[model samples]
Target: MDAGAAIWEYLGADAPVADLPAMGYGEVASGYATTHSAESVGIIGGGYVGIETAEAFAEHGLDVHLFEMVPHTLQPFGAEAAATVEDHLRKQGIDLHLDTAVEGIDGAGSVERIGTGDHTVPVDLALVGVGVAPNTELAEAAGIELGTTGAIANDRYGQTNDDQVYTARDCAEATHTVTGEPDHVPLALTANRAGRAIGATLAGDPTPIGEIAGTAAVKAFDLEVARTGVIDEESAAEAGFDPVSVTITAQSRAHYYPGGEEIQITLVADRESERVLGASMVGREGVAKRIDTVAAALHAEMTVHQLSYLDLAYAPSFSPVWDPVLTATKVLHGKVAG
Candidate 1:
């Protein structure tokens, strides 16, 4: 991996907000928290990083005020599904401000308060989690091409334009299986796989990196959120597929089982091809593994019909006669036919 990237400051980009000068210069501060002792903290952008960091601070007895311009926290999960996790965040004592714009983060040398146009929240520190762009300065100077996502351009084996130079991890893009195109995922899992493939290539064994599964998971207090593949109708359409989506609520275990939890699954499939496009899940337990099953199906390019008949292990205490995953695809398959 190269130098990775810095947090992008996108608030009030064109017009300067009072004391803040430019996008990256101010309106926010740059710092990550392994731990902090401040009484109150203000977090900008309620995406993955912002929500997790807010949860961590709330658990440590620090007052947290999370601000997001969007109506929901997790953009990938959609507003409806993301609301479930947002509810839990509020119950955990995190002050959430939805559909709120922060004008600037101002202080002498450190952040003292965040001005959001209508109100100002006092904060000892501010963490910005807007997004990142790859550090390709040196690579660009060396005549290396950059992808559409502004990340370093490289082949599947981490070989750059110059055969003598190689790069991997967050700096480069990977071929997404769904789109059959290069995308900047920058997740640790993809980074690790790319690193391994590059090592094999250097050892005289050419190991072209496999396609990305487009999988990710995160825990929000009591809820564990997992999703993979396309999941959104717009994305599926942009990738050249007629998308069909369905949502189902199922039990995590047999009805007769003593301990079980409610699992909400939203599955998307191709309308014409009946192929499983993507899926998302929100629940307390059995989340990480269930999403992995779908991730494997995505890797294998399984259709909705095939996924419906998957021979997953089942036990009264562990899973119901028909697992939640099967229930979701079986429903989606019917819709595909209809």
Candidate 2:
């Protein structure tokens, strides 16, 4: 499949910072190569790739400046989650320029600086992590239908507009499990799973590409951030659910355990139906695995009541008697039950 391109069109014609000597490390592929060294690097966009790259560059001792056009990074995770991450990023000395627009990239021969309206940041290297869209030029040229998300239109079996042609990976549109609507999550797992299903289809064994929950996890500094399903209240309500959410800071392990840490979990559920919608979690430990449990719950359509009583395994070294996931669900179950 023609997955996608690293260069966002607005970043300029074919080459990103084409005339500049700056580097572009792709979220997927190594976007643009770099041979030059730099003391300072400017990262454009503060979404997943941008933030992760910024953290990496910062760790390598580069003065990192991350610019986001939005008021906050990780807007999909909402303000609270974004703030939690932004605070950590700030603590690590990442220069965050939120709600700032890049006026232009200016330099004599290579990128010397990037200008936001109020300030001009001198950057030795400029890395653009502005995100990517589906590579549908070939799909479009072949008269294939594109979904609302601009990815190639496909069915559960991954057949495109032309039955003989198929689309998978980042280029294909997927249906969200919660809303049962067309979505383009473009995550590695989604791409890999969809690709497998398409392979089965081509082999005469039609396997359904399951609905996506938009489950994902990323590590930002000391934080393990994970999110899944319909965590957005507005989106849940729009999907005909009366969404109610509860956020709690709970211990990742037994309180008396030596390695215990605080894990913040935000659980979303339907007030009327009592079914769990989604969850957002972040912590220094025990977050990544816990988020997978919620993803399973989402797949099973488990209610907060069900999730609260999941009978998960627990040990002081691993989790508390009531796992953080359980604590979050139990708390949400109370609100929904009430």
Candidate 3:
């Protein structure tokens, strides 16, 4: 994919594409095996791939510097959650530069340094974790229509603009369950689900796929972070709702439990309808599994008030009598009612 050159060109780097090492995901491990002795490494992009790769290199005792064009890493997560992760990464000795773009990758022959607008950082290895672009060349050649997201436009049954053509996975867009708008989220589960629906439809069973909530999770060092549905303030408003959110920090288990850990949960709801819209959580433990509870609420269109009373299991080893998810929902329910 020549990712490094692609990013350099995208950022208006003076170097030619052929001059850079320009490796893709498949090439990263082999590249690293040869370059592991390098003292420092720089990564472009602060999204999931970049963040995970940076953590890997840093854990191996190499100096790691990460660059993000956006004001924060993990833009899919709300600002507050992203800030929490950024803080944790910094504490792990990762040098993160937010709101910064990689202007160039420079060296005589092999990679040596990465340039931001104001300064340059010396590096033995540079990785480009910027997002991928789908290869729709064959589809375009066949005159298949591309959606606004630049992916092949497909219906619920995975049929494209042309009845004879069908698309799925990273090359196709799916309907957003909340916004009722076409979205191009390339996640493994969504792809697998969509493929099953498409297969059924092709076999004449005609099973139409339901829309997606964009649920996902990731681990940053010891912190578990997860989010589901529409967590962005602007996105909720754009989807035609007045959104209100509440964040609460509570114990993962009984307060007196010896091994209890602090869990932070954020719940977003529509002020008018009071329906739970989205959720984000960050904690040392119990963060990954809790997002599913919120995801189920979003799928069922349950209101924040209803979520507060869900029949969630509670034991000293598991959760408090008032689960963190319930606590956030209960608090937001009050705000929405007030």
Candidate 4:
């Protein structure tokens, strides 16, 4: 399929029966060929999309090259959490080039090389999943207002500046569920939540949005990495809190349980309030499930003490009586206390 068709499928649209945009696999076949030849692939931008794509491509027998202009992947996730992701990526043979930018992608109508200052790689394909901008040309010509981020400036309920205007997905901003800041977070979950908020308001119930607590996860190369809330240091400070972090390396299931795996978890909290802020986990085991538990705790404004004592279900086949998250919480609580 062509790029447009691929995008349509991604958005869950039915395939065009009559006229489908034809992709030149022959004309553009060089890009695909380069991908097949190179053992290593480089991803620019270490956000959720970049990281997830890197993991997927690496698993398919390609040497994954990940490039991030920031100091680490997942800039919103802060340094400590990014480190856990990096560790997981490294285990999968992904080469992370952080604090670097791709000068350009060079190829003859297909990607053959990725160019950087003083560096060049004969890449099979240069996956430029460096995030995206609002496809707002239609909105602009129609005179819709735009946010500073180039997204549509929607109200708490997803209503744009115009009375009849509503926006979601990559086209709108959302209120931070914790900090109450209006932010343009291009996540599907945010779009859905904002849609609901808009629906409620349209139904005559004016719902207010809280601060956006960014949430994302990735399952790549059999490793699960997930994070939520403000995981970055600057974000915490911007939200008027001093941040403290703790990392825990623990078993996924009971040690006695067969096939149990190891997981690394990191929790970020306010140094003064001891309130849970953001967290991340990485493992070939049950990292996503565990990170979700912490994500829930952060969303509900639960403190470390509360999360530590959460009445979580347990079984040796799935989890220990005290899950890794509970243990991490207990660890964080101790740090907060003493």
Candidate 5:
């Protein structure tokens, strides 16, 4: 939406890796596929990649065994939040196995059995999304020092410790706005922002890089999931703020609108300031757009008062006079004010 040519430069960040291997990027790049003959496929990690791969394998007539070590499906994001997503996942015929961890992956050459601490499960494929380490091998091989998270460390201007080199994307580190700590948040928006700021600096304009708000969105079947700012309770606590959160269900548009859809919005605000710190939304019909609006507000350091008063378009055919996002903001404002 911020189309000042500064932003458009990041519209095309090249996709470097094709498909990920069970092990490393090199194995993936060398054309490898490890599969077995089994009715059920085991997927390790219930994060976005694991769940998506599970759904795809299931559609091809394979029963899916989704292993997530967390008591809830997506840990750190809360059980209630995970349950809403798991419901949709189960409908896709995936066997959601929480509290399960992958001990080892075994096969002669191709994958056959996935080992748990208790026993081994026979599977056609073992998909792992335990998370990713930075693809810093290129930078590392060239003697660019790596950080604790295995990312290429860059200064505020996207310059690596090496002056001539500029890096963005999953390979680079990010400065968290809330905690004032550096992290590796390999998200598209972060990459885009970094690219823009770096491009500006390179093109005769001196723009200082700002803190990243950690916003992201995803689509899982009918669910349009988006989370912006910070949702990690640990991070919130560490950031020296008492975080209060609320969840509400509302229609995407006015109830009177013929095709109105339902969505769930969750908001986190500072207990004392009532300033929105984070937001998550799950539903249909432009859910990502609505979340983006809140994300912008969070970046602008807007309070719930400003969120409630933000000018968002509305029509009986589009949204109620009060959009669901604004409505949720008003709710948080009341809770904080009271």
Candidate 6:
């Protein structure tokens, strides 16, 4: 919905909009929601939402062009992971335009072309998935205070500044476990958990929700991309850690296993404390669940060295003797110790 509004705002005209209903960020947009068809389509933003939407349209037989203002897509997952997905997208026939911005949209009654200041791509439809903002109008109208994130100021119990008012879901603020600062992540799981905690609190049980690591997963073509905690160098630094990271490619199963798959793991840790700050993975299989394991480690405040020694399950058909997570941690342990 936010993405659709941005497209109309950029075009400066009211145009027919098409909504794509997707389950989470990874799943392809369901075809049931698409009421119209186009020969060519333009997508702005190269993040998870944009990438999935682009793939969905292309699969429906439309020529799709994607634009990203940054040098690459999937910025949240960092550069190397972005490069991996970029290679896959190009191979899948997506016309990618990185380091590019959509300056305007031109058409008569609907979208026809997308302008990028220097160049234009002819398209029958355009989709914008840049980002979303908190819906704070009602809170503002009620005179409830908002945090620096522009989200409704709420305590751990999900109570707004006014004792009688409360906010949750996309409009509420939650604390980041590592940074210890309020952040508005607005993910589905976060909202659901926060709602549960708030319900418990209102019932007089007073269960406070713990801080979150902002974990997420997305599927790009055949690749399962997942990240947990703080993988971005800048975010890690801002959280008061001198970040060191290492990326390694390892097998998902035993070396001799017939169906073994390649898994890429990037581990980030603090140079001084050696604590594991975050991790990301991209693979054909076994990516999403592994990221959850890393998220649990982050919640428990485990160090990279500790993760390297974790007694993870191992089987010929499931994981290597040293799981990819442990393997990456072992390599990261050396770097942090050195």
TM, every model: 0.86, 0.87, 0.89, 0.82, 0.82, 0.88
Model 4 Cα lDDT, one tens digit per residue, 7-125: 33332334572175556433344334434455556677888778877865665666778888878887665676578778767877888778788898887855567758677666756
Compose the digit string of candidate 5's lDDT tens values, residues 87-161: 888887777778877888888876778868686787756667888778887898888877766788888888888
Decoy 3 TM-score against native: 0.89
Candidate 3, lDDT over the whole model: 0.84
How accurate locally is residue 320 in candidate 2, as Cα lDDT from 0 to 100?
Answer: 90
Ranking by lDDT: 3, 6, 2, 1, 5, 4
lDDT of 1 at 55: 75
lDDT of 3 by residue, 64-119 (tens): 99999889998887887889999999999999888889999988756788967577
lDDT of 6 by residue, 186-256 (tens): 78998888889888888889877668888999988888899888888999898899999999999999999
Clashes of each: 0, 0, 0, 15, 0, 0
Clashing pairs for predicted structure model 3, backbone only: none
Candidate 1: pairs in clash: none
Task: Find the number of clashing residue pairs for candidate 3.
Answer: 0
Give stretches of model 6 more than 4 Å off: 1-37
Q: For residues 1-338, what per-residue lDDT tens digits would candidate 2 score against the true structure?
A: 11123332222235433444334333323322233346788889988888888887787678999999889888667666788899999999999999987787877766789857568899877887788899999989989999988888888888887999988879888888778888888899888888898899899899988889988888898898889998878889888999999999999889898978889888999888888888888889988778889989988988888888888998899989989898888788778888
lDDT of candidates 1 onward, in order: 0.80, 0.82, 0.84, 0.73, 0.73, 0.83
Q: List runs of model 1 lying over 4 Å from the truth.
A: 1-37, 108-110
Better of 1 and 3 by TM-score: 3
Q: In model 3, how large is the Cα lDDT of residue 100?
A: 87
CA shift of 233, model 2, Å: 2.3
Error in Å for residue 321 of model 2: 0.4
